[model samples]
Target: MQPVLRQLPAGALLFHRNAPAYGIFRLVTGRVRLERVTPDGTTVPVHTVRPGELFAEASLFSSCYHCDARVVHDAELHFYPRTALVARFRGDPNALFDFAAGLARRVQGLRTRLEVRQVRAAAERLLLFLRLQVDAGRFYRPEGTWKDVAEEIGLTHEALYRALAKLEATGRIERLRGAVRVLRTRPG
Candidate 1:
């Protein structure tokens, strides 16, 4: 089946929690955030899907979405119907293997994020995230705002600002226009 193309603006919801899962999506551009609304009515961010990434893969086997998928930036995506994809997977062993491999990698990344979130100190948490996620030059470029990075690292926006200030003051990191350059591994 040919995938359906969709264009959505920021704040548009692609799907709601408990919504029937008909298909999976591949983001061609922009950002989509997966959030779970708690019993207390608080929205908790689960994950952010970037361009070139596929989301709601579990929907291929599940009956409904586990969380809400909201567009955080104007986005373009391709929707692949689950039935057709599953049929292709069954017929193509290699396709199934590749999909499973991608899932495993995503799981590993989630584990790392969880570990970073478990750190108590905001500065320490931010430092650990940079250390783990930075490129070879030890620079971590945020895909969104500092608030988004704060959310990803399980810190309040104020706390993230304070942590960045502390890190910069201590000469542990350099805050560039759109990136954080890690000068050291730990607070000095």
Candidate 2:
């Protein structure tokens, strides 16, 4: 990974429209807010990328950032330059495979964005967001706060807390010390 260090405050933009595509970043700590604005000036917040996720990969092939990426909370990232990434794939087939996997994940993230936009009900949106938050059948980080979940599901913090409590009380998740454990869902 290309080594770049920056400490951004909440809502600090990491990338802007037409910004140079220097590299891809691996989240080391904190939260990143993915935001896109429509031509009509409507802002759509896609999600807050957690640690262990990659952001701004679109810059790899494109010359400019298509949207804005901001930090929802303080964050640390490892930036891998575009040239280094391109070179890695050029040398080994496995590197190419890894790149493909990463690209696939970006596509899935976009799909989730579309789904969120399509759903009309906030409750449904919250449920879908929670489901996607799972990794390998478990919540990725129980350390996530109600604010994180609220932003992801596009709900108010109070509403998110209520929704989460409802899910928890129903045995869909268990509230732990610092995280919530996802209980298995029933097959629809």
Candidate 3:
């Protein structure tokens, strides 16, 4: 199947909530943010799609998008037709297995996020998120801003700041310009 390429500028809306589910997309370059916006304009980020990852897979069976997808940076993507891909999966068991594995991983990620949200203490939640990042090979001496980190970890900016301050005071983390380094962590 020939994939359609789309180039979007930063901040462009690729798909909005309740919009038609055209196809699944693979981010070829740059970043995309998938979020659910409340009626009053509050945005709750669901996931961030990076290069080589697929998004909108749930749309394969659904008629409409459950959330909005917006380009966070200038991005290029390839869209695979939903029906054709579904047909291919039906024809190839190995392809279906691989697709199921990918979906499972996405589900596991959501489960972990849910667990993080359940942690009562802000510090523990932050630590758990950092440890998870480290385990995923996504943490490298922390190049992301604290605000971005907070958002990704589902913490309010103020709460994250307070947690960071406490962690720093306890010698658990060291903050640097545009980055945070985890020194050590212990159960609180």
Candidate 4:
């Protein structure tokens, strides 16, 4: 089945928590965030879906969404119908394996993020995050604002700013327009 192409503006609500599950989405461009609202009315960010990534895969089997999906940036996306995908998977073991592999990679990334958040120092946490995310050339391009990154790393915005400044001052990292280039692997 052909996926439906959609364009959504920032702040658009794609789905809500406990809503009937539709299918999965592939982000061709822009960012989407999955959040869970607590009983006390606190919205906790569960995950940020970036371009070239898929979200709501679990919805294929579940009756309802566990979190709300909101478009954080102007987005281009493709929605794959759940019934179609399920039928495809049932007929093709290789397709199922490929999808499972993608999920495993996401799991690994989450583990790395959890490890970064566990670091005590803001600078150290930032460094570790960069180390894990940077490419072979030692450059990391942030998908969202520094504030978003700060929250992801379990630091306040002010602390993240200070950490960035410290890293730059110590010649550990160089800040580019939308990226950070790591100069040293170990903090000096």
Candidate 5:
């Protein structure tokens, strides 16, 4: 395990777009928000991180920040220096596999998001996103987004509502106003 150098309180933006390369973050406590900004400078909440999750480690390989990381709740995190992490990652073959696996997951996650955006039926895309979230054990409401659900799932709000009704009718999932709860885990 990496050493924790500091504890940042809630609402802290760990790294702004041009911030220094701080290696990988090993989250030991609380949550982090990964936000995507639009061309008009509108900040959209894309993902919420929880304890035992790693973020920004991809930056270790490239020595650059890709997205803004903000703390959603108070958190204790390791602030590994980029040089050290890179050296260790290169030296250990096993570690390299783990790193590669992680990067693959990140890539797959992005691909899923894009697929959700391109899907023709709102119900199908919404069903897929909920299954992915449930698989990750993440609940979306606390992150302050359900609207982003409609937007990112590439559905009009009315379409998302209609899809929810459809899913509920089939007993595939249950929809609360701010959240979706899985009735059964879909096979991977």
Candidate 6:
């Protein structure tokens, strides 16, 4: 089945929490942020989907979306209907296996993020998160501000600022206008 194409302007809410799960989305261009709002009205960021990545996969089997997905930039996306994809997977073992593998990778990423957030030291958490982002090529030209990163890493924005300041003072990273560049250490 042909995936349906969608174009959304920045700040558009693709779906809200508890909404029925119609399909999963593949980001062809631009960025998307998945977030959940707490009962106290706090917004907790879940993940940021970049180009070429599929998001909301968990919604495929679920009745509803676990979080709200919003466009962070003007975006072009392809919506793959869950029902159609499941039907195809039933007839194709290779397709089912590949889809499972992608879901496994996403689970592993979330596990690693959980471990990083468990670190008691805010600086350590920031450093680890930054390293992970750098490894993913998402650090240098970050899609959102440090505040958004703080939410993703489960830290307060003030704490993130403090950690960045410490890292900057130690010359571990260079802070540009809207980016953070990790500096390479010289071997003695």
Model 3 lDDT, full chain set: 0.85
TM-score, cand. 6: 0.59
- Candidate 3 wrongly placed segments (more than 4 Å): 9-20, 28-53, 63-75, 134-140, 143-147, 156-162, 173-188
Model 4, range 36-145, lDDT digits (tens) per residue? 98999999999899788888999988989989999999999999988889989999999999989989998998888888888998898998888888743477887878
- Of 4 and 5, the candidate ranking higher by TM-score: 4
Q: Sort the candidates on lDDT, descending order.
A: 1, 4, 6, 3, 5, 2
lDDT of 1 at 24: 99
Cα lDDT of all candidates, in order?
Answer: 0.89, 0.75, 0.85, 0.89, 0.76, 0.87
lDDT of 6 at 120: 83
Residue pairs clashing, model 3:
none
**Candidate 4 Cα outliers beyond 4 Å, as residue runs:** 9-12, 36-45, 71-74, 134-158, 171-188
Compared with the true structure, what per-residue lDDT tens digits does model 5 show for residues 1-188?
36656799999988866566777787888888988777799998866776676777767766568778888889898777788777777889798788799889978977988877776778878888777677534443525366657766778878888998898798777657667776765689
lDDT by residue for model 1 over 1-188, one digit each (tens)?
A: 58899999999999998999989999999999999999999999998897888899988899899999999999999999988899999999998999899999989988998899899999989988888877435678887788889888889999999999998998888988878898845437
Record all residue pairs in model 5 with backbone atoms less than 3 Å apart, i.e. clashing: none
Error of 3 at 5 (Å): 1.8
lDDT (10s digit) by residue, model 2, range 1-188: 44677677787888877888877888889889778888899889876688888778768878888778888778888888788887887888897898889788888877887787577666556666667777425764534676866765568888777877777777777766656666777789
lDDT of 3 by residue, 82-108 (tens): 889989989998999998998999899
TM-score of each predicted structure versus truth: 0.70, 0.60, 0.65, 0.70, 0.57, 0.59
Those runs of model 6 whose alpha carbons end farther than 4 Å from true positions after fitting are 109-188
Lowest-scoring 10 consecutive residues by lDDT in candidate 2?
Answer: 135-144
lDDT of 1 at 73: 95
- Candidate 5: residue 160 lDDT (0-100): 80
Error of 3 at 98 (Å): 0.8
Candidate 2 clashes between residue pairs 3 or more apart in a chain or in different chains? 2-80, 142-179
- For model 4, state the Cα shift of residue 134 in Å: 5.4
